[model samples]
Target: MQFLAALLLQADGTDLTRPDLTINYIIIGVLLVVAAVLSVIVVRRRMQERDDDWE
Candidate 1:
């Protein structure tokens, strides 16, 4: 989490006038997005496993 936080904040110290700023935003956006995706995957897998045990 802290690593993500640092990555998220990494842009704050940089000047947006550079082209890399745009790329950084894209990377951070992707990271945040994948976090949601992975969380959903985990919950779904856990539920499926639990359901299978009930049989």
Candidate 2:
């Protein structure tokens, strides 16, 4: 039981402890920004095409 407690408290080779999540959050944020940019680009392209067709 004590060994299990220690394992949970300590970082092992397999991340047996509370893992640092700063990098994960940053990666997620970056991916979200990229997705937003891509979506905006797609919308702008479609709008430009539509405008050209209308005019």
Candidate 3:
């Protein structure tokens, strides 16, 4: 994957040089996944606490 990234960076045309927009899109996607995973963890913890309170 690192080799592919370097190879892609060296390749020609607008696809490689003007990649800021593409990078932003990829960053946003990664952030969204992180947020989703964190939300799942928070919800599971809350549910567990609620169950403990009921007991």
The candidate that wins on TM-score is: 2
Compose the digit string of candidate 2's lDDT tens values, residues 1-55.
Answer: 9999887767455654567999999999999999999999999999999999999
Q: lDDT tens string, model 1, 20-55? A: 578888999999999999999999999999999999
Write down the TM-score for model 1: 0.55
lDDT of 1 at 51: 100
Alpha-carbon lDDT, every model? 0.89, 0.90, 0.88
RMSD of 2: 5.4
After superposition of all CA atoms, the RMSD between model 1 and the true structure is 12.8
Clash pairs detected, candidate 3:
none
Error (Å) of candidate 2 at residue 6 is: 12
| Regions of model 1 farther than 4 Å from truth | 1-20
For residues 1-55, write the lDDT of model 3, one tens digit per residue.
Answer: 9999878777745464453588888999999999999999999999999999999
lDDT agreement of model 3 with the native: 0.88
**TM-score against truth, every candidate:** 0.55, 0.67, 0.64
TM-score for predicted model 2 compared with the true structure: 0.67
Top lDDT prediction, candidate number: 2
